[model samples]
Target: MTESDGERRPAGELEASVLAALWSAGNPMSAAQVRAAIPQPLARTTVATLLIRLHEKGVVGRSPAARGFLYFPVADSHGLTARRMHQELDQDHDRSTVLARFVEGLGPDDEAELRRLLEGGGQ
Candidate 1:
């Protein structure tokens, strides 16, 4: 979906939170432990489902444990955000169209500033 047209999905929230919890923990944690980190009382099965979703998204890693899967975030939030940003930029098909739309939307002063930056006049 286009960035403007795409609304946030429940799966996205769950995925983000699972990553956050793992980031805060800084270690692999069991499903129950991850669920406890979440604000709400989530069923272990629910967290497991979210974990699976994250794993599919390439944002989390899983390992087998005695009682259940141990989960960890594959990267920190900033790294993940950078990946998403890179994906969005890479997905744009027409480079000229992207630049045209970007410049067209800028105000006069902003446009001038961007020009200067592109010309290596601004640091």
Candidate 2:
């Protein structure tokens, strides 16, 4: 199905929506709650499946609820982003080159902040 049909969405879009919902909720939520929170018109089962996949990927955590489960994001948005950056860095063999390129791509302020962090001035 195409996006116009509302039945289909771009890859990872639903998952991102679900994660956003959970993050905004600031608490574990049932699949039904998540489905209602997200803007997408998805079935509760679909949201549950997305939560399960996120759990498998270690992106979300779940606890047994009275019915099935309540899901929550394992980390805040920034933490997840940093984890993804580490995962990307781990994929490459030439760590120094990747680090250099990443540092080179930073703006002047970001570069200075990184330098300060590296110098143990910022945490």
Measured by lDDT, the strongest candidate is 2
lDDT of 1 at 85: 65
lDDT per model vs. reference: 0.83, 0.92
Task: State the lDDT of candidate 2 residue by residue for 1-123, as single tens digits.
Answer: 677775557649988999999999999999999999999887777888899999999999999999999999999989999999999999999999999999999999999999999999967
Over the stretch 55-118, how does candidate 1's per-residue lDDT look in tens digits?
8888888899998789888888888987886677688998778768867999999998988989
Pairs of residues clashing in candidate 2: none
| Strongest candidate by TM-score | 2
- Kindly report which residue stretches of model 1 are placed more than 4 angstroms away from their true locations once superposed: 1-9, 95-123
List CA RMSD, all candidates: 7.7, 2.0
**TM-score of every prediction relative to native:** 0.67, 0.90
Candidate 1 overall Cα lDDT vs. reference? 0.83
Query: What's the true lDDT of residue 26 in model 1?
Result: 85
- lDDT of the structure predicted as candidate 2: 0.92
Residue 102 shift from truth in candidate 1, angstroms: 5.8
